[model samples]
Target: MADGRVDFSTPKGGSGASRAVFAHFTLRLDPDRLTRLRSPLAEIFDELAEEGPSASDDVMDVTLFTMLYGLRAGTES
Candidate 1:
């Protein structure tokens, strides 16, 4: 994504009696917002990690993960 190439999973709505979906997105955050976002997001992920093992098994695993990342080595500046 360093070269500005972002990725997302195609939204899916399964053929079922009720509506369901698995969606994903990538977004560009303004530089100034990064600091404000990191700590809260980390705490959320930590809480989820702690609660994960006790979650009931009737549903599949769902996750929300994010990171601060850099572009691939050969990408443009």
Candidate 2:
């Protein structure tokens, strides 16, 4: 999405013509995982803040929002 180059390998017969398709699949998978990771992290962050000392919320929110919103663009970006 950021106009960057990625290197990935696939099955020989399914390789060349599938570069764009496979890259799209792999990129989509990472965001799904990231969104999953962020959900629990946000919950833990909220609990920690409620209990005692905690990290900065603004930083965390911005990071998570950026990631989630960025994923909406998909590989076409």
Candidate 1: stretches off by over 4 Å: 1-32, 55-57, 69-77
State the lDDT of candidate 2 residue by residue for 1-77, as single tens digits.
36544423454677465333321223445666877867987887788668764466623121122223333555754
Model 1's C-alpha root-mean-square deviation from the true structure amounts to 10.4
Worst 10 residues of 2 by lDDT: 58-67
Best candidate according to TM-score: 1
The list of candidate 2 runs beyond 4 A from truth reads: 1-29, 53-77
Clashing pairs in 1: none
Q: Write the per-residue lDDT of candidate 1 for residues 1-77, one digit (tens) a residue.
A: 38743333333564433333344666577656766777787888889778766546644445455556433448668
Task: Evaluate all candidate structures by whole-model CA lDDT and list the values in order.
Answer: 0.57, 0.50
Count: clashes, candidate 2 = 0
Q: Give the TM-score of candidate 1.
A: 0.40
